[model samples]
Target chain A: MRDRINALARLVPVWAVWLGYGWVAPWLIYRGATGGLGAEPIKALERELGEIALQLLIIGLCLTPLRRYLGVNLLRFRRAIGLLAFSYVCLHLAVWLFLDVQDAGRIWADIVKRPYVTVGMVAFVLMIPLALTSNDRAVRWLGARWRRLHRLTYAVAVLGVVHFIWLSKGFQIEPLAYLAVIFALLALRLPDSKSLERRTR
Target chain B: MANRWKNDLRARDVTPEAVYLDRRQVIAGAAGLGLVGTGRAARAKVPEPNAWEDITSYNNYYEFGTDKGDPARHAHRLTVQPWSLRIDGLVDRPGDYDFADIMARMTIEERIYRFRCVEAWSMVVPWNGFELADLLDMAGVQAGAKYVAFETVLRPEEMPGVRYPVLDWPYVEGLRLDEALHPLTIMATGIYGRDIPNQNGAPLRLVVPWKYGFKSIKSVVRITLTDTEPPTSWNKANPREYGFYSNVNPEVDHPRWSQATERRIGGGLFARREPTLMFNGYADEVAGLYAGMDLKTYF
Candidate 1:
């Protein structure tokens, strides 16, 4: 009973994350809906969904580092956070597909011809299997292979950053900064790289 | 949605009549160059007059920066004095025309028109310039010429965006011979009865009211009469999103955005969207130019 309470308490921060900016995409979007999204509402909405998805992906990537250094075991919430990221990614693409690009032929042309759209589509494709196999049944069925399959998250994160960089016009530092942080987070996951590991409780 | 406008702003020319008369002479000498067909076709019906801040500050001259607000902030660094225009390629007379010489030969007139961005934002602007057809005639277009290509100045030191590959350096745009010869095509030099600000393509710029705003290349330095179609900057960068013939077709949507409707720039977030018009409401004047051609296929 005591262990159950402790586990529930640890998950509070996770719930906060699920409700906070790291995962509170729907809520933020709801706010934009109520107040209005500026002159070009559809464009603004499309960009917001894409940006929130990126931030959620970054936060999802940081879970391993949190466990390694701060001893905050967020592993329990990783699946939920990842699925949220995927949902946002799907939503982002949906907005672009349905509301923004109404012409079917143009949509195909954009996905095939534009480098930025191609990269973004590739990233979204990489997330589909991860989201589909996220349930306990798939985990139990695949066992060890599930971990291997889910490892594709690393590549998905990298592609997401690339998509952002390519879409931006001019030499913007914000997307570049996201790239740097993502690289650092991935580097921390290296097998022998334990420089930041906490020594004691 | 027609382009025919009946606005009070035309009645209020902020410039004094004395100076207005002095400037009016620029257009007086030109033979048979009437202010493009707004009266005959009566297409555009623009609503509110954009505020001075919106007119001067809100611009998208990507050579200055990609952001709409960046041009007004960054374009001041550009030098417009002693500018020259190169009129060449498939022409009888091909040479560098000094800014003073070009202005001397051209007729300037006020043109209040609806300006629409492919991003689906719209604005109304009053511009002063001469018919581009006059300049094309002055260059003596060869019969073999089938297109008119325009190139913007590339000053990396002054235009910071040029330093980065936001787009190809020296922005280039083109129009078919028939489209280029259209009466609505003007090379704008001023706005609101004053010399155009540097951000709004000071000295000179192309204004094709019937096409997407990007078709109106800014800070123009080169005008070439070409026998073949020319590659445009945005179309070259992302051909899927921006077509070479970026005529304001309400039916053909952009790859990632809708062209059916537009948000008026100053209309606030929740304002009703104004329906987009075919050829930006200049359909009466330009629809025949694309007869038998499928805009969607070319688009």
Candidate 2:
């Protein structure tokens, strides 16, 4: 009990951040539901949530790189950041499916036919395994294979950026700028000694 | 394929053709060149000029750039001054028309039209320009001319996207000659009581609100009359994704998303998308022209 309590203590700050954001999403939904969103509100809400999801994803991806660079060892909080990212993504998908599309056939087609949505769906699927295995027991049971499986995060990161760029119908630089920052951070892992830990071990 | 889809949807009996016909007349009138003879005019009810204007001026042609608001923001880098429109192929007069001379001789007029994007949001705006027929007449199209292709300016220095081939650069769009000469088709220069901002396809742009936004070509530097369906930039890049017609119909959804509704920009969250209209509500004037034809196939 004491050990579990201590573990919970370490997770508190991350949960607070996720909870704060999650709390605000409902207020936004309420405003949207009550007709506060106005003529183009559905799209506006979807766009806002999509951006939030992207930011959360970026933040989650950043945690690992930041830990290594800063020597902060904040790996304990990575799971929370990732789960929050997934939660926001779920919200984004919900808004699109229910509020925007409102048609299951079309939504299913989008997931199947559209390259952007396909990649996004794949990234989401990959995330599920990571999220499921994030607990201590799964990590211990999976042991050596677990870290290898989680490396799929890099693939998810790349897909997330591609999804963003694809969604922007026109050639705008804002998405590109986001991609550049994420790319630079992820690229650092390519030649780093920490990434090659197995050989040294 | 487009025709089959429309026919299949028609067979579904969910959306009535009568409802679609009500709006089709306006689209035909706007798209009909002066050639839409007198017999056709009396049969179709004239649509009232559109009443809104905010959505007309703001747009994004991914062929040019990607922000929903970017075209109206970056379009100015294209210099309209000393503009020369090169007209060639299947035309009696194959030459360049200087912008100043064209503006000087053409009868310019202002018409208020509702601009509906395929995205489903819309705005009514008054635009000032000459009928495209007037320009085509100036060039004197020949008997073989079936389509008029418009080429937008390509300059990496001005249009940064040119270097990347994000799309087949120097976007190309075409219209059937009749469609090109439609009374509603305008080579516009100004909007909202002001000279069009650089971002709004300044110098000139095509305005075909009934069709998808891409049909309204921008920053055109060349016009070529051809005998065959011209290869459109978007269609060439992804033919299955973007058809030649690209008409705005909610019933026919995009492969990746539904076309049933669109968010009118500037409207807050939770707002429902307005129902999409057939031929963007101009079917009455144009439907009979394709009475025996299939729109889904052409689209």
Best-fitting candidate, measured by TM-score?
A: 2
Off by over 4 Å in 1: A1-53, A56-63, A66-184, A190-201, B1-46
Clashing pairs in 1: B2-B43, B2-B44, B3-B43, B3-B44, B3-B45, B4-B43, B4-B44
Error of 2 at A28 (Å): 9.0
Per-residue CA lDDT of candidate 1, range A1-201, in tens?
Answer: 545654775867656655654445565556544434533455666788898888888888998997776666667778878988998898889877866665688689788876779889999999999999999999999999999999899999899999989877545666898999999999888866344354331
Model 2: per-residue Cα lDDT over B210-273, one tens digit each = 6887788887789999999998987887676688878777777766556776654433343345
> What 10-residue stretch in candidate 1 chain B is worst by lDDT?
B23-32
TM-scores of the candidates in the order shown? 0.67, 0.71
Question: Given candidate 1, what's the lDDT at residue B139?
Answer: 84
RMSD of each: 10.6, 10.8
lDDT of each: 0.78, 0.69
**Candidate 2 chain A weakest lDDT stretch, 10 residues:** A32-41
lDDT of 2: 0.69
